[model samples]
Target: MYGQGMSLRFGVLGLLAEEPLHGYEVKTRFEEMLGGTWKVNIGSVYQVLQRLERDGLVEATGDRGDRGRQAYRATVAGISGLTEWLEDPDSQPQLLREDFYVRLLLLGRQPNGHLARLLDRQRRVYLQRMRDLADQEKIARERGRPQVALLFKGGQLHTEAELKFLDAVVDEMGKE
Candidate 1:
């Protein structure tokens, strides 16, 4: 998963690479940076911070913030990892199994009307998500956040591709 949306660690590293941030700041900045596409819990952020600290990718700044929260900054190795990850082009699927593909296979056993309804519902959801992405993209552009806008654009493109695949599935199902 070395694509734009890699694991949360890289996101955390990228955030820290920009500047030091406390656990709470990391969580909030992550959500803000990605235009709210990924909502990470505060606990998860702290856990990642601890892991990053243990891995020597980050270190405590020895500065206490509000409520005694310790701030952390990315180390040189962390920045180097971030650079390497960005330069890597390996976007191969880590897992051979995809949940949606499995669900589609199961749905193949169902009647046409049932499968049609499910597909329709999914299409509607994708459409709504595209709309949301558009809105987020606009907000990001207005806020002068080009990276966030680009992220939203990627989401829009991916969702459009999914919709096309769904339509192709419906067409193939009709052939049977």
Candidate 2:
């Protein structure tokens, strides 16, 4: 099961690809990078770090921070893993299956279900998310973080796309 931990492991590796960091720095940076949409727990970060170290994906640099926490950097193996993950199109299914696809399946099972109504509500949520992302992007740009701003803009675009999809679904269900 490549479950929750796998996602976090990859996220950690991706962060390490930029620079070395301790567990706490990883957690804080991840939260900041995602604009707080994904909040990571320190304990889980430590657990993933230990597993990454054990797997030789990352190595302790024998460097200690002001707080005395050990810093870790991604190894060659970790960089290779990150590259493969980035290039894999198969990972899309794992992402969609857990959220949108599962919701779609379970929502369809109701005997008297109004799928159109479900879709409409989802569209509203996505629209709100898009607005939020836009605001975040503005802040990122003002802070001179072009990379983070680009990420937020991408999320806004994707949410806009989802709204279009929901509209199509609503229209199709109306024809049923």
Candidate 3:
């Protein structure tokens, strides 16, 4: 369901479900909500919004100001669509382009002590990401974006788990 469409569409719907917002508000909120992980251009957001409106999933309200700021609200169809998309089965597994994982796989061919250093560095980086995710989660919760909060929480948990696993690997290597 999510695969057949751009993730930005669902994200925009989710945002609109909260409250009516202008295009500029949507763009700023989207970037803020994703913690800058998803860089959505203004053109793309407007395009998706236009498509959503054309599909009758969203409706635009009157201009709000002298700048011609038109606000968009999620229609009943949009809410249903977003709910269905969230409930859909794994249309596609998330693909992570993890350079560290690739390096770890190739570490056996490297010189002495290199793997240990790399793993140590990975642990540090993962810990930092965990911290960042935690911070994002907190911000999302404070801002009343529970869905965004949940996303960041999941990321934090995954990073914490990876950090723990990396620490174990480093310890085992040290004993070898």
**Each model's lDDT:** 0.87, 0.84, 0.84
> Could you tell me which 10 consecutive residues in candidate 2 have the lowest summed lDDT?
89-98
TM-score (all chains, Cα) for each model: 0.86, 0.78, 0.67
* Residues 1-176 of candidate 2: C-alpha lDDT, one tens digit per residue: 24344667898999998899999999998888777778898999999999999999999989999999999999999999888877765533444644775777777777676665677678778888988999999999999989889989989888887877777766776787
Least well predicted 10-residue stretch by lDDT in candidate 1? 90-99
Give the number of the best model, judged by TM-score.
1
In candidate 2, stretches whose alpha carbon ends up further than 4 angstroms from where it belongs are 1-7, 83-91, 98-100, 109-113
Scored by Cα lDDT, where does model 2 land? 0.84
Residue 132 Cα positional deviation in candidate 2, in Å, after optimal superposition: 0.9
RMSD of each: 2.7, 3.1, 4.1
Residues 70-112, model 3: lDDT tens digits: 8999999999998998788875655344677778768946777
User: What is the TM-score of candidate 1?
Assistant: 0.86
Q: Provide the clash count, candidate 1.
A: 0
Residue 86 C-alpha lDDT in model 2: 71
